[model samples]
Target: MTLADTLKGMIGLDPTAHADADMKAVLAALKELNPKPIEECSVAEAREQPTPADAVRKLMTQAGHAARLPLEVEAVQSEDTVIPGAAGSNPARIYRPAGDGPFPLILYFHGGGWVIADLDVYDATPRSIAAQSNAIVVSAHYRQAPEHKLPAAHEDAFAAWRWIVESAASLGGDPSRIAVMGESAGANLAINVAIHARDSGLRAPLHQALIYPVASNNIVSISYEENRSAKPLNKKMMLWFVQNVINDEGDLKSPLIDVVSADLSNLPPTVVVTAGIDPLRSDGEKLAEKLRDAGVAVEHRNYQGATHEFFGMAPVVQAARDAQTFVSLAQRQAFGGVPLEEAP
Candidate 1:
């Protein structure tokens, strides 16, 4: 038996007890890879850890499927551009669908706890979103932490949104129908951009889709307690990320960081997605409740048997596929138009 199997046998842990069948399979395959625990690794080592996509690609290769790193979707055209930011210029990639008059725009942010990962590591999501929703997708890359620190990524996100709004027409996107969407830390930025736009009297997003967002700094909620040891994201790993991003403890309470404390009034219609096995699940739930209480239209969905980082694993995880469908449907309804093609 593998070391992971031996460990499981010794601990009497059943994979199905916490995750769905497909997720169990993923976990098993991942365990066989014998990756080092993030908590015990240095920042560089943690950053080099294999992502779920990497593991899935390996599994597929082992199963006789062709290995395709950074899965691609057929967008009619894609271009990379640089957007000016407070610190420096940020790189952004825009994806346009085929035969588009002026498609609705989705300003997408990728998740990396505001530190690791980048547009290249998360190419599959925006590609899939652009193809599935037939919208112009601008995937933005922001400055990371321990070098740039907290609030830098947030500022870069708002700057990217502003740039998109100002240049939407040139990008073949309708400014009036623009939306903000992201996963994990990117989701935090998406909501913050909406709030910033509303407060700044700029053109607010028509909608915001946040997938497994980091909504609050309080990590003692029931979900956190239950999933503190969850793979991909755990409490210890989160603490490491927090330490790397924030300058000090005081930043934890900032409204931009602790979104539950932020004024949610008059924000755009919102959809918050949560994973059943993620520590941040309660964060999403609390943020949704706060948005609704502030009189904003809100839709919250918690996918059972899903774990953190599952949002971008649609190629392997059924729950992720379902979540992606939910996100695309929400975007379509918010954009107030039929998709260029029906969502699968």
Candidate 2:
């Protein structure tokens, strides 16, 4: 048998017993690709690693299905702009649903462990959010690590958030109804943005939706140990990302990075989404609880059979679809719209 077949057999008679069927299938496909561990690969090589969305797209195409493209919402138009930043300017993409008046705004951050992925790699997420929530989604393309390093991306994220808040009205967005949303590293930035807003005496985001955020600097947590070998985002990859992003281990203690230990009070209402098989699952769970303890209105959901990056694979992963729906409903309610049913 081939190596993948051998590995699949080793998992158990039914590999899907512990994971969603689609998640298992995607992991199998990823194994077939045999990507090198991020720690052992150059940044360029690591960038080639198959994302969950990539795995799903490949599987669909191999099965004679059309490739799933970013959803196009009717009346929604996207535009590219350069926002003034600490460093000259930052590139951003804005998605606005078709409407005459201002709409709720979401300042979105894309995840790549703060290193590799770019705005294009995460286009589907903001597009989906904009379409589903009928809101404006402004996705920032922040400077990456090993090139710009920590505090750089954080500065960019906050600057973008500040700029959007000030320019919301000009862009057809309602500043009063703005929110922050992101996945993984982006989620970290989203939370930080909310924290910064609150501390700076700026109007905080109405809500924050974090999908499997990297909340803690500690990598030895229970979920980290349990999902050390998880596909898409293994512990080693997480470490590699940390190494590239931070100047030294001392930087880990910074509140901007170690969000779990940061002051969480006075932040906006929050929704924390975690995947069962993701190494960062515990981080999200713990952050939600801490937020609640700090008197922040919080909602937490953990999808039992999903993996890291599953939130962006909605075209094939049912859990992703459900998670997106959950986020959209949360955004709608936060924006003063009718709420849909909560996620199952």
Candidate 3:
């Protein structure tokens, strides 16, 4: 039989079956937490549900991979601090490189649909960014929706960005070479922060890495249909998130919320990452296209067989490891714009 025929014979012919085995394994482990469906749960209940980070740790520990990690992974130092915002303050974690002296600074934002998740739930990605790029990463949590509502997270993100720009130097970071990185809803905030920096004449980010951003409002796109029931994130869950964040239809027209329709010119070099099995795949892809059209330098990487939240599952998923490496290399290039050899 042909290769395709043999593969079909072994694992059936369902398109959904094309998902990575490791990704499915993590999803299975996530299901073990018995989370109520997002559309069916209260905001508090949704926040209490098992996060993708939990699933990654669960799968690794269960498979006996936790004990195999290199001890050097602990070299990076992490400390908790508070980022002062207009309304109040948000908790932030700063990760410093092992062998560092004024390293490049990266301000990271966590994805939770602007309704759930936090810095702790997103610990892996920022730590991985620090370990791989040897840069200082400050991952901060913004206010969520239904309680704080729309623009609250965005306001907090800007506050965090401004704080990072003003304080990175004092924190042993090279403020001249700063970057922004985020996943899902947080990606939405990262790009907007870069824009706000340009408008405010603040120190602009040198680069931005957005993973599976919520760029376009077109939730009926192909990925939504293809992965309508995707685990961790889906069309139904997105609708739930939207309702919680937006007070009304007018909120949808805000340039901060309507990212795809906003001006994207003169932004920093960007890296947009998309997962093949994710509902936000088209969102990232479309954002990348918009950046290119606006004369911005952009690189888009679509990880086939990977799902949303896979970027933080490096310990249990190969694709996650590869994605981490890709982002780290991209961030390093933006930091120095130097080639691999003949330099420090």
The TM-score that candidate 3 achieves is 0.92
Instruction: Encode model 2's per-residue lDDT on 21-109: one tens digit a residue.
Output: 87787777776777777789899888887666666767787764344644455456888888877697988999987666689999999
Pairs that collide, model 1: none
lDDT of each: 0.83, 0.85, 0.86
Residue 180, model 1, lDDT: 95
Best by TM-score: 3
Question: Cα deviation in Å at residue 77, candidate 3?
Answer: 1.1
Residue pairs in candidate 2 whose N, alpha carbon or C atoms collide under 3 angstroms: 75-98
Candidate 2, position 149, lDDT: 90
Question: For residues 1-344, what per-residue lDDT tens digits would candidate 1 score against the true structure?
Answer: 86545444433233236788777666767777777877687778877877777767666766644434223355346888888776789988888777746999999999988988888778778887887677999999999888889899999998998899999998878878999999999999999999999999999999999999999999777666667678867777888888999999999999988999989999988889999888899999999999999999998999979888888777777787888878888888789865424644
lDDT of 3 by residue, 1-344 (tens): 86545533533223346778887888888889777898899998998888878877777777454634434446778999898875898899999878848899999999989999988999988988897888999998989999999889998999999999999889998879899999999999999999999998988999999999988778767677677777777778998999999989888888777798998999999999999888899889888999999999888999889988999888888888888878888889888845423334
TM-score of each: 0.90, 0.90, 0.92
Kindly give the number of clashing pairs for every candidate. 0, 1, 0
Please give the range of 10 consecutive residues that has the lowest summed lDDT in model 2: 7-16
Best by lDDT: 3
Which runs in model 1 stand beyond 4 Å of their true positions?
1-16, 64-72, 75-77, 339-344
